[model samples]
Target chain A: MKITPKDVAHVALLSRLEIPEDQVEKVTGQLNAILEYAEMLNKVNTDGVEPTAHVIPLSNVMREDEVEVSLARELALANAPEQDNGYFKVPKIVEG
Target chain B: MDYSVVIGLEVHAELKTKSKIFCGCSTQFGSDQNTNVCPVCLGLPGVLPVVNKRVVEFAIRAGLALNCEILPFSKFDRKNYYYPDLPKNYQTSQYDLPICVNGYLDIEVNGETKRIGITRIHMEEDAGKLVHSGNITNSNYALVDYNRTGVPLIEIVSEPDIRSAEEAKAYLEALKSILEYIDVSDCKMQEGSLRCDANVSLRENEQAPFGTRTELKNLNSFRAVQKGLEYEIVRQAEVLDEGGKIIQETRSWDETKGITLSLRNKEQAHDYRYFPEPDLVPLQVSAEWVEEIRQSLPELPNARKQRLMEAYGLSSYDAGVITASQAMANYFDVVVGHGADAKAAANWLMGEVSKVLNASNISITEFAVTPENLASMLELMQKGTISSKIAKTVFEEMVASGKDPATIVKEKGLQQISNEGEIVAIVEAVLAANPQSVADFKAGKDRALGFLVGQIMKQTKGRANPELVNKLLKERIN
Candidate 1:
């Protein structure tokens, strides 16, 4: 469970980060400290203990079947980096 | 190249409650962007979540419907993660002690009953939607809309019991139908109401150890879930065959490209840094409360299917179709409540009514044909006021214009020609004109009876009573 410097480098690559070399060492130390604490969980006797996924015992959340109004085109496109008409603008996704 | 596919489904359904699970924000979909949001939903500082009572009730109802055991007490936990769409850095989900556990949903595929194990059903708040601006090409920065944030969502996780793509699709459909029947959620995949993530892996038939599985994300439709699993199965199988290890990872299905690309390395169960939620109090559900919710639970899909078979004397297939949604089943009862024949109503609802609903891409609730109107339409048919053909025309007009059955029948002048003299004249004229059928009927060819009846009904412009016409034809033949 020891996250070494090389391990952090690989994890960062998998996570799609462009970390500078100096920062990689710093992040590796930070992640290792976190993992060391997380490893303490192995000490607890989880044998036959169910892993908890949610605190509330519930199921079948639903809504009524109806068509409500959608946001206006302007609102939908407000945060877009680029747009045309009502659609979000993007680079050519496909070649002609 | 013998292999078995192991598949599991994680379904996230937005519950049907009027308000968000943790806040007072409206759970309505398609509201103005961010209009349904509040400080709690936006994760503003100083706002704390107040668990919605209806959220717990709906969950208990769902657990009962799925035959899950409700825990006496449960608590929420923080699943810490950094994501732009999640206004809160961490999602408040159940880390352990989910609301319900140990349930099974029996699904039928190709006439075989496959019992899929339900691991857990837990409540959580949904993340906001990320609106990626610009075209598919060079896109501008994306905007995050928190309208859907904090909506009540129940994530139903099933044990990996599925073995094929078709079975995965069947499981989703059956689950959606059950949810729809209980009126817990709309379960519309197109509206981002119900979404699915399929976990897929391939192994040899007798392999002791399972192969690495890939999680395919954001499959919004039944077809997509099936197709995504199928593609991943093929992809993993090919990888393993080449003596390459199948990587554990999260993958995205490029539906247009028909390939799954790795999105990120798979996070182990410990990666989320789960801890008990500090803001909300631990939920204490009493047995009496659980029993009350269980008793209040509506008749689910299977139970309703069984009753329809017994009470209405319908075939199993007919019952299954009619009981797919509570709304449709209740609509049928209303028609039957008004004294229309159950079998006739079932046939009409399954046939012409369902056809129109599908063609227009809407549910029965959206159609203008109310239960009373449908009942009266059937009444017209029973009383011989309109022939089946005329009844269909009137039913369409009733649905289109929201007109009453009698009004449509009156305006269309579709009364059945039950006059005995008028029917006898038409029968006599048809018997005289069709000498071949008359000769065939005399020779006792059983099908010739149908030909003679057709001739009379055609001559009468389909207005004659089919039963009376048949009786007259049989008597004349004798």
Candidate 2:
């Protein structure tokens, strides 16, 4: 399917990207070309093969219910843009 | 035109585990802010998540309790989203292949059983909470507490088979009880251990298919679930009656306002873009393990109710009430363990214990009186050390002061006055003072006999031995 500029913008918004209006067209073309190239692979016939989720053939990776020491409070908030009373602060979360 | 309400509930219950699902952070609630955070739960770069073994076991037990078919293999997927409370931009959840599928629960409505089909039960991680800085309408931002991040949650999705709000409420109740029976989740709605989101729609008749549906959120309690669904059903019916097209949207239940407000339209729906998580490997549950978990399953609510009825000779209603909560059921068994009669144990649990717990607004788990104390208090009544009336006083003292029944009876001087001479003197005094009731008793009025008996008991402050008072009064009157 051919991708549209509006679809690209919607995806960008969902991804929290602030793309400028002038770059929308250029980015849309690049994305659509990538999509077109990927769509070509869909033509190959592989109906009998099972879809794979991971590259390695591993399964059931689990751990026992043991707790380890956590990061120090200072280090945890080192990269955060803002912090208050040992918490992550963010803009209003409007969505339900 | 008459419309039938069709509802499907999505219940999210936080599993009871010592640590978070994907991290080693403590899963305890109401902790200091951010104290439970670790690199894995905080979504720091280059950190990998390992599945908690208990989470998987709890999910399987839940599936078995709900009578679901556990898939031999299941995988976790990343549900991409943008929310402040989610430390990670994407949540690890089950996508196309959930852990359990095609389960059904039977709920009772008007003494008739209605089966609600469960589409799937999947495992996922919960997000943290955001305490808004100001009024919601004008808040600049919010503070995020990551304590709940990575907490294991199982989302049980139900089919849209519910015909009314009452049925929806019943389905939720049954689901909560089953989870509580297995001791997987605390199922405390206030603490957000058990939460529900409902999808509701209306149709003109059974012949007509389900109309456009709207999803509702922010239902924190069972009352909210029922009331929210009720409001949505009526709101949809009114729109249909007015010839307005029903729009697919997500609505927020304004509990204070008692109306649902449109949160987002269909166009604004997020494309969650779910795909299998590459970091975590797929889960392959073997038949042996599933069988082992099944064998270890505790007796569920319905079975326990049936057993109570058979073992205690209690009516179905009484058994059902006593076993509604797991803690209460365990308490009932403990009370019986003290050698109290099973029927009496059930009665105390259903009547006096239930009433006190409700009035105190505390759960049976937090009750001050132990089963031994309660059983001993019942035994006090049995041994005639205290009349049932005075036993109530001792019961209150035991509950309030956490004292022993016998000690409370002794300290308060509330023992039954069974000594024949003392009761005879009290009865004679009552008969002399109430000459009217004495004459009425002589005239063969049984009601007056009861009145005179009541007067004697009142004179003894409800501590009089009732049988002795009756005998002494009868002999004197003759």
Candidate 3:
């Protein structure tokens, strides 16, 4: 599970991080250290152990099967970076 | 070289908890962009997450629904990542231990039942949305909306048991219907509330180790999931057949081109650098708590479908359609509860209501038709107060104006002509007018009987009772 310098570079590209070429080495070292610490988990005899996806086991969480109030136009657009009237404004999504 | 496509799905459904999984932020969809958010959800400096009790409860409910074994003790882990959508540098998700494991969903494909094994159902927070700026291809900047962030999500990962695109779609549809029936999520792909990512690979036969699988990410619709997986399967098969090594990578579906293009190489599972989330405490679910959730759990889709078949004598297709959405199923029950015929109500819902909703691209909730209104309309039909044809007309007016069924019937004067003397006179006149049809009916041209009935109905202005008219017409013709 040791992450090489190449691993950091790959992860950076996948995540779209603007990492400078020179800083790749430094970031790789830091990442490798984190990976090394994480490797300690393999020390447990988890051969038959199950992987956990959720902490609690329950099923069939449902509402009352009714439609409640929808967010108002103002509330829906309140935090938009840009808006026109009460609608969220975005650049034209289609080309003519 | 021919090959078989092997597909698996990882569906991420937002749980129906009132709050976020790891924070107290409301799990409500369509909330103000950040009004439901809190410091913990924002991942502010020095703030810690307190696991929502309902998150665990919901996860267990999902597990139980899938018939998965519930872990006695499960814990959260930090999945390290950096993205604008992810407020926390690391996402709090289950890693080494999940709430539910080793479940299976039985889906029918082409009338054959196939059981897809569910590997796990893990809980996590949903990321925020990224709205692109000027251009989608090359946007200057993207606006981040955190309303979706911190919303509880359960990722249901299935084993690679599916062998075709149709099977994949069927499995997803069955899963979606079940989730909707259980009231977990709206499971609306358009809303990004229920999303699917598919993993596809092709194999020659069972003897080989698995091929390098490509992950198709963020397919918002079932059609897209099916098409994306199909395209990938073909693309990978062609590549491997040409002696090209199939690269393990994540790809994006270019919906316009109907093709999948490379997004990024597959990240190793270990690349996540997962560790137990320190801020949230390990969840200890009591047996009593699990039992309580189980007791509170509604009848799942499969069980309800069976009950509908047994109790109401509904056809399997009708039962399946009615129970597809919890809302629609509950609506069906309401109408039936009001003394409407099961088969009759199912016919209207599956035929009329569903048809209208599908054509309008609206949900059942968007229409003004209530269950009581539908039941009363059907009752009018049963009581011989309105002909079936007239009932439909009255029902439309009811939908448009939300008027009472009786009022619509009264206003429209759509009552059936069930008076025996009146019906017999109309039938006699029709028979006398259609001598050729009466002669043909005597000659055993059964279709001529239909013509006679049509004439009588037309004379009565489409409100003639079909059963009564037929009885009178038969007697008069004889």
Candidate 4:
């Protein structure tokens, strides 16, 4: 129900974000304020209402399983910061 | 310090769809890297993912086959995680409301039918492939292939009902065959179409509360599944005996080392913050649609197994082996349809046919010998046209040349020598040459009769009608 500096740090770690140590308090306060502001919706006592995931009032928006033309390899990797032999290369992930 | 091993398998099968789950990209394997990439699959900005209709149908078909309850109202959710294989930080999967729930599959282990409860069957998109520079432990960098990203996958989660490695294997085999029978997934583990993970733990006894479990990964084969779990059980038992707690973690099966190594501990485990996927709307399955899908379902493995037992009068074991593969079962049916004796056909299929298939590492569909040809060969042996021994030689030639049984018999001069005159002369010559054996037979050495029969068969190149040879040899000796 409340955001703490430790919680903020954990969230940052999970999101792969590095927050400056001096700004942890500031970020924590900002997250709490956002949660408090959104918490106003809890004041409404409509307990019988069903939870809503989307507001579009639609279901089963789908497409047929058919192959369409795909992007060329050159175009697909055009924006890659680093690539090798038709692949997107990244830093070593040994933690898996 | 007795403990019970508890195992639950989570199997992921890539659905056989023409395109990726959300995008119109080909799902063909072994394509040039990145050729199947699209904006949606690559997680490019400003792109929306639409559900693939066939994926939902396949999920329902699997659910029905596994005896799961198909929820009319189901939706997808985003499971937040970070990995290089995932283009998006989170995987789009079903968390709370999976499409199918509370199913059960019956697996036979050691001649006893045990029902493994299915926890849920959810539809999800697969991650991309990561080709490491070396092994995961020492890889400097990894290359990513987005071709498999956004491919449709159904994750079937099982309860901790499996008590042994053999039971776990039976469960996996049953699951794979069902998926293959539904024509939903190809279920080829070598190609990564079918993958399995296990949650294993050891409790003091069956009545004890569940203990913390470790999740096993990288079990790429059925043998690995069984062997890995066996090793894990021993490892856990050792830990408990030493008063060391079993640390709940993810372990990678080091197949080369024949042991499981810890990849990460519980402290590093991902806290997947799953929330509803808003981009894709909820799926509303109608009763009519579910029924239609159910009606369209092919005869599953269990049903086919039962029918094989009843119709062909096969034993439970034989029926189980034959119906394990749909293609193999269909081949059996065609062989029977061609007027092959059911029991004889079952023996040949389970014996010689399966022997050749396993030795050549080919499937029944890829086998060169046709069911009609196999039936003809069986007929040759059954009708006394060729002895069973000669039939085997004929079968070997048919397999080598893909020729008809009759032609192989004719070309190789392998036909049974049923002619009485021909066999009588050969029997007489065998008697004359082996006069000691003849004397032994007349002096009541029954074993000598077998030796004389062997010589006669040898002289006739194993083409002598064994029954006729026995009768004629007995008449002449007496």
Q: Which candidate is the best by lDDT?
A: 4
- The regions of model 3 sitting more than 4 angstroms off are A1-96, B27-38, B135-137, B268-270, B359-362, B365-367, B403-411, B428-453, B467-478
lDDT of 2 by residue, B188-304 (tens): 999999999998888878878888999999899989998988888888888988999889899889889999988877555568899989889989999999999999999998899
- What lDDT tens digits, residue by residue, belong to model 3 across residues B34-65? 55665666676798666666667777888888
Tens digits of lDDT, candidate 4, B70-156: 999999999988888998888999998899999999999999999999999999999999998878878888999999999999999
Full ranking by lDDT: 4, 2, 1, 3
Which has the higher lDDT value, candidate number 1 or candidate number 4? 4
Interface RMSD of 2: 2.1
Q: Is candidate 1 or candidate 3 better by DockQ?
A: 1
lDDT of 1 by residue, B1-478 (tens): 7578888889998898887877777777786566676667767679867788888888888888888999877878889766667767788899687999999898878767889999999999999876765642345455566778888889999999998999999899889998887778889899989999988888888455677888899687887887888888888888888889988888888888877888776764227767987677766678898898777777888888889889989987888888877888989989999999999999999999999999999888888888999999899999989889878778889878999999876776778889888888888888888889878877878888888887776766677888888887778767
What TM-score, to 2 decimals, does candidate 3 have? 0.80
Highest-scoring model, DockQ: 4
Give candidate 1's error at residue A63 in angstroms: 20
Question: Quick one: RMSD of model 1?
Answer: 6.0
- TM for chain B in all models? 0.88, 0.92, 0.89, 0.97
* TM of each candidate vs. truth: 0.80, 0.92, 0.80, 0.97
**Candidate number with the higher lDDT (2 or 4):** 4
